[model samples]
Target: MFFIMIIILSITYTDSYANSAHSAIVMDVKTGRILYSKNISAKKPMASTTKIMTALLALEYGDLEAFVKVDKNAVGVEGSSIYLKYDEEVKLKDLVYGLMLRSGNDSAAAIAYHISGSIEEFSNLMNKRAKEIGANNTNFKNPHGLHHKDHYTTAYDLALITRQALLNEDFNKIVRTKRWISEREGYNTFYNKNKTLNQFKGGDGVKTGYTRAAGRCLVTSATRNGMQIISVVLNDPNWFNDCYFLMEEAFREYSPEKVITRNNDIKSFRINNGKVERSYMIAKEDIVIPVKEEEKDKIYIVFECNETYEAPVRKGQKLGKAKIYIGDRLIGTTELFAKENIEKRKLIDIIKNFFSK
Candidate 1:
C-alpha cells in the first residue's frame, strides 16, 4: 500500500511520513526548518551525499580556475569514477563537474590532493567543515562518498549541508548545470550521472549514490510555484520514486507566507510608567513561514508582553515574544522589542500638573 501525507511545509514537522530506509528528512531551505523528519538524528552511511560537503569545502578552499594534476593515488580509487588516468592536467572547474555531475571518485581524489596535498588531509578539512556547519552528528573519512566504515551522516545532516551549499552562489551554479565538458591533454567529456537533473521537471541537481552496503541513495532539490524543497533518501529500493512523491506532496500542500515585515507596526500596548501612554511595536525584520495554501487562514500570531517595565526602556529592548501558531501547533517564535524609548514620570511633575488642573 502506498502511503502519503501532506505537510504544510511550515517550520514544524508534520506527521507526513511512512516507514522507509533508515532515516529521512525534508527541510525548507530558507528557514532551516524541518518540514518532515523521521529518525533524522539517526546516523547512517550516506554514500555520495557526502559529496555535497566535499563540493562545499572545495568551493570555499579550492580555486575553480586553478589547474590540477591528477596524481597516482587519485587513479583507480574505487567506485563511480570519471575514469581519469594518471597525470591528467585538468582545471579545477572540470574536476568539480566530474566530482558533482559524474560523482567521480577520481575527481574527488584529484580535488583533495590539489587542495590539501593529500586525501587524508582533505578528509580532515571535510570534518572541520562539517563541524563549522553545525552538523554535529556527521563525520567524514573521505572526499568521495565511497562506502567507508567510518564515514557516515544522517538524512537531516545531509539536508543541513545542502542548504548551506545552496547559499554559496558558486556552488548552486555548479550543481544546477546539466552537462559540463572538460578539455585536458586531449578532449575528455563526462555526462552527469544525476538522472533526476534531466528526467524530472524543475530538477536542479544535487547528487546520487549507491554501494552494496549503502543501497540506492539520493539527495534531490527542486523549485515549483515559488516553493523550493530538498529531499534526502537513503538505502531505499526506490529512492527516486519516494523523493518525487514527497516533493509533489510538499509543493502541492504548502506555499510561502510572510508573517511579519521589517519596520511594520505589529501591535500597540500600554506602558505602566513612561512618558508615552501607548507605543506601537514594529517588527525588527521580516518573518516568513511556509504553510498549506488551504490553511493560510489558520495561521495565527500572538503577542507576548512583559508584565512590568521601568522607565528608560530603550529602543530595540526585548519586551516580549511573538508566538506563531498554525492549527493549534506552535511552529515558530520571534522576539518582540520596544521600538522607541519612554521617560519616567516623576511624582513632582505629576503633582504640579494636578495642581494646575
Candidate 2:
C-alpha cells in the first residue's frame, strides 16, 4: 500500500486571530480566561450593547408576569424602538424581550422606569451592578446606549457583564432565543438581530449595535462540547465575521484541560503524632483551565502547604493549595484537602508506630 502522509499543522493564536475592531476580546465563560485581546480595556461607546445591562437589571428587579405601564417619557425615546405607546400596559418580561431581541430604546426606557422609577435612578443601579460584576471600566448614562458623552464600556468589562448576566437562567434563555412573541393582545413578534445565531453552528446570543459614533459593535457567544465562548467587537465594519473567526479560533486552539481532578491524590504530607505516619492530600474539585494545545506541554503545578501537619486530621480538611502555571503565568489555584482522617496516636499506638518505623 502507498504511504499516506499525515501533517498535523500546529496553529498558534497569533496566526489565527487578526481582528480589525477598535477594541475586541474573546473570553472562556466558565473559567473567565481571556483567550484573545486587542485593546480590550479601552473604553468606547457601546451603542445598544448597553441594553444587555438594562435587560439584566430588569430581570433581576421586575416580575416577569407583572403588568408594566409605559411612562409617557419612555414613548418617544430615540433610536431603535418597539413602538411602545404611552400608557400602554405590557408584561415586564415581554418588554425585556423587546429590549434585548429588538434593541428597543423605548423598551429600555420603559423597563428602566418601571424598575427604578426613572432612567437616572436606573442608571445608578446599572453602575452599581456593573461594579458588583467587576466591570469597573463601564459607566452607564442611560438604559439604552445612544452615544452619550459619559456612556462607555471596555470590551473586557462588557464581557464581564455578559458573564454575570449569563449566570441567570432566565437571562440565558432570553438572549439565546431567536424569535419571541410578546404577550400583548396583537402578539407582537420580535426577532433577534444577532446574526451569529444563524451564521455559526452553535451561536447562541449576546447582542448587536450600530451608531454614527460607535460605528458597528457586536457581542457574540457560542457553546460547544461543554464550553462556552464569548467575544466582543467594537467599531468594526466586519463585526460578524471578526466575532465568528475569533470564536472559531478559540475553539480550535484552546480547550478546557483538567489540571487537577477532584478527590485525586495530589501529594503526600507527613503527619506528626498521629496514628498514620503520613496522609495524602487531594484536590477538592476539578481544576480546569483553558489552554492552547501546544501550551499543554508547558503546564506545571506547584504545591504550597505546611511541611508537616499535626495529628487529628479530618477528611476533606483544608491542607494546602495547588497553583497551576503555564510558562510562569498563574492560570488558577485549587484547594488541597486531606483525603482521609488521621486520628491522634494513643500511647499504645505510638509504641507500635515507633516499632514499625
Error of 1 at 98 (Å): 0.5
RMSD values for the candidates in order, in angstroms, are 7.0, 7.6
- Residues 41-153 of candidate 1 have per-residue lDDT tens digits of 87788888888887888898888888888899999888878877788788888888888988888888888888899878999998888877677788888888888888888
Kindly report which residue stretches of model 2 are placed more than 4 angstroms away from their true locations once superposed.
1-15, 260-287, 298-324, 333-357
Highest TM-score scorer? 2
1-357, model 2: which lDDT tens digit per residue?
Answer: 010111112233475699789998888775667888888779899999999999999988989999999999999898898999989999999999998999999999999899999989999999999998788899999999998999999998998888777767898899989999998876489999887888897898889999999989999999887677899999999899999999998898788787777778789999999887887998756666678788999999889898699999999898887777788776666678899999998989889767999
Q: Tell me the TM-score of each prediction against the true structure.
A: 0.73, 0.78
Off by over 4 Å in 1: 1-16, 259-288, 293-357
Clashes of each: 0, 0
